[model samples]
Target: MKTIEKNVGKKNIVLLVLPQVQLLDIAGPCDVFTSATRFLANDQAGYNVFIVSGTSDKILYSSSGMSLPCSHTIYDIDFPIDTLLVGGTEPGVLHEINSDLYTYLRHIVKETRRIGSVCIGAFALAKAGLLKGKQVTTHWKYADLLQKSYPELEVNINPFFIKDQKIYTSGGVSSGIDLALALVEEDFGTFLASEIARHLVLHLKRPGLQSQYGNALPDYDMMSSFTKEIRDLLKDKLGQAISVEYMADSMHMSVRNFSRVFVRESGMTPGKFLEKMRLDQAKNLLEYTDMGIEMIAGKCGLGSVVSLRRLFLKHLSVSPAQYRKTFKRAD
Candidate 1:
């Protein structure tokens, strides 16, 4: 693990933005770096963060229709860049970008210490052939398209962010903040990163392995009528101790037949679906209320705090308390 101690002075963080880029992808990481400077001692070095436009335009319009003024183009930067991040744009606009931007990216890779993308900016990096055979991620909705377009890359949509050697890619818009905080933690230490997160009023500094979707339910439209009925029943009685036999009886079928039909319709056994439903309920309670762990556990039919912790750890890689801290609504 290398640190900013290797660098002699302030590290230069250059974010590249194009027309119709997502604003948060540019603003989030920049704010993280700028905020870090406020906590640094006068003698200590910090980050010099700036934006460079990929196009020749002096001003770029974001996807949200906000205008962003840029003083430098990619060609204008001659100094070494410690980190270079690409902000995301719509998929349609990605196709419209000029080839010169890809050439510039290929050329700039030689001068940068590290490079990364926020959201669908992975497409730009992929277009430049910078991510061949790399395990990466983008927004979950576009994960399949990214993989289909670039067969050589492994696209995993689970995590909020991921780092593969010197290259990084984040899940969606706000995950840029998570990625930037990670970079800060890497350059300095956890103490500085924690301080920055607190100042930003961030509830949780999520790990890279944490799933982007949490325990959210899959699309109901994709489920069969039988599966939907079962889901409805489970939702109403999530706090009760439900057995496979009870489910079978409610559906008016033999236990064996119920198991086979449920698997056929839901793609999972009744027990597995029940557990997933319980986990979803538990997550909802954790995020929306101030209930204690034991009460939440009982209400979700998870039995005890130990069982609840185990369920969260197995599925989410985070403890119940940690998940609550990260996602709980503000009072």
Candidate 2:
């Protein structure tokens, strides 16, 4: 690795690229730094950005068919990389990364001040032995694959991003921008980061602790169609007083058989699944509406505000009011 001459106080931000990289994973963060150069006026842009291919300095096409011409290759760039960021490749293209690429990544890890990945790029980091036992995250869809592929790594698919020591891992595409903004906040200040976020039209500087679970019940797709129908019934008729026997009767199965099959297929008991659906609905209503807690509970089939409160406390460790305070968005 060659070290570039220091330019007073500028940070060298290098994005490691590969063929068929997720384009947003590269463009989003790079645009942030480029925009930051203008936002942080008077001072020369605090970062000098570079894109380098792990194999060769040539044109590389992204997953979305966008072509980027790269002038620097890992083997050619001896510059000091203040921060090294790797963009993700589609799963189909993931096999293109060879042993030489991992070796280069390990070498760069030794030279760069901080090294991180965007989305499934964490897979490469894990391959390079950089994420052993470290808490990280990636796209929710790929989280299980990453975990199974690297049993030594701790892959949580919840948070928008995670920072464990010098390695930062972000969720899917847009969150890469959030991760970059967070880095800007750390290096510059909250005001600058917030301003950049505002410039990007983002609502707020979302913290890493925030979950990526969208406002919907996680469907148990592996379950039988009959079981899924029962689950759908529970969601649709949340306000009604329904029993396990009723559910089993609807599915034309005995209560004992229904319970066993439901649990085996869905990985959760029927009762627990119903409760989860109701609770997830209640949470969505609270975040997006001004409905009172009692009304929300009634609507979601939690029966009453007291029942909803107890469930929230038991499962989420927060009361309804506190949850609303933290998550609700103002119109």
Candidate 3:
């Protein structure tokens, strides 16, 4: 394994792009690094960024139907990579890495200073055997699949990014920018990274361990029809406090029996599941509306701003105002 200290002069940052690549995953991080060079002024400490593919001159279409230009192919590259990143593709798209590509990845990893994947790009890294015994993260939607398929790897769905020694992995979409900012902070300093983030108009530099927002509904296929009914009922009544007895009665079961079965099927106690659903709804309202904290809390059945604040702090390490400020999209 090569050390980043061995690299001098401008580091070469390369991104490997597969077909159906998520455009934002590549562009957002690339822009972060590129902007750092500008922010550095006369520092002369920056990355030389470029894109590579399995084959040259191939016009790869993004998942959103945009064409991306590739500068080089894996078969032709001869330079040392200071950092290597694999950008993500749409979920469930089959990635066929031939022996040649796999061989190249395995060989290059030995010489590269650092390597990482963005979102579902973890699949590629896991396939290349680069993520063995490493704690990693991906888009929450695919976290379960990644864990099921690669039992040897530790897949965490909460964090926006995870770094196990020199290997790094990031969660979905814009989280790639957070990973890039972290790399910039590592290579340069917080001053330059913060400058680049400000230039990009990012709200906050989210820590790697911040919990990811997930769907409110539980997986129906994994639960009984009665459990699904409870889940549905909870979804519609997120703003109201419903007791375990009420939930059990809705499913025609005793409270003790319902609690046991709920945990067995959903992997969470009923109380915990209800809390998660309420938090998700609160997050949605925070991002999409201009509701006041007290109103939003009442709407989510959190009862009061004080109660919501406690849950937000416990789960996200941020206050409701902070979460809203950081994640609210500009209209």
Candidate 4:
């Protein structure tokens, strides 16, 4: 083990891609680092990106159906590393964590500058003993399983990602992009990193812990059949006139009882839940489309641009126009 006191000049970075890696997980960081390189004065040769695997020639497939070519096997790379990114594969895709590979990772950890994982990649690091006794995070779906496997892991379930010293871990699919942007900010400064975020059309940043409480990925079956029915109706008629009384009648219950059951079951008032859902959709629309705010508001059940701006101010801390402008830049 040696101390990384000498700042290694823009050096080689090995990205270890795996079988059934999630598309966004690998693409997110690649976009960030590649974009960051172009903006740096160091001629963008700072990073030597290599797709490494256990068997060098194996076709690395992602869950999104993209097949990436492997340039070298783990055993083939002899050069020292600056960053070693361990990518995630589907849960059952690669059951065998090669002992030799594990040993190799442990050896390299001492020399590595920073280690990173997107989503479930934390699992590989944990298995390698690199994450033991360290604060880390993974996609919430696997948070319990990872903790149960290694109680020594101080798993933070609330953040989209967590970093303890040189090792960093990110939450599920989309959070990988956020994690990559943060990495860019660290390496090339916020100015260029924000530029990459703009080119990628990603929100400049999102508080890592914000999405955990939104209840988006929670099982919808947690709601009863009737409750689901009403919710589905709301999704369908987002622009339709909706009220507590109307919602109650739609579910064939009295307004008072419906409100009580909705709150009891979902942990939020029905109106609040619908508002969150609408705002979430509106946020996506604002980022991904060229539609006017008024149009997005109409589609998201918020009625008008005014209502959408008010929601953005309270929840996202930016106006709809501003978010779009900041994220849609070319440079």
Among these predicted structures, which one has the highest TM-score?
Answer: 3
CA shift of 161, model 1, Å: 1.4
Query: Cα deviation of 10 in candidate 3 (Å)?
Result: 2.9
Better of 2 and 4 by TM-score: 2
Give per-model CA RMSD: 6.8, 6.6, 5.5, 8.5
State TM-scores per candidate.
0.66, 0.67, 0.72, 0.61
Clashing pairs in 1: none
Q: Rank the candidates by TM-score, best first.
A: 3, 2, 1, 4
lDDT of 1 by residue, 1-331 (tens): 4333322478889899988998999999998989877677534577888789998777999999999998688868767899999999977797787789999999888888889999989999999999998999888656656776788999877788889988999988888999999998888777778888999888447654535264434446646799899998888788889999999999999999999998777666898889888888898888899999999999999889999999988878789999888888887
Best by lDDT: 1
Summarize candidate 4's per-residue lDDT along 80-155 as a digit string, tens digits.
7888787787655546656776777788889998887888888888888999899988876666457767789987
Q: What is the TM-score of candidate 4?
A: 0.61
Clash count, one per candidate: 0, 1, 0, 0
List model 3 lDDT by residue over 15-61, tens digit each: 88878889988999899988877665544567789888844445678
Segments of candidate 3 deviating more than 4 angstroms: 1-7, 35-45, 54-57, 95-104, 144-159, 191-195, 198-230, 237-271, 285-306, 321-331
**Residue 322 C-alpha lDDT in model 4:** 73
Model 2 residue 102 CA deviation in Å: 1.2
Where does candidate 2 have its weakest 10-residue lDDT segment?
208-217
User: Ten consecutive residues with minimal summed lDDT in candidate 4?
Assistant: 1-10
Better of 3 and 4 by TM-score: 3
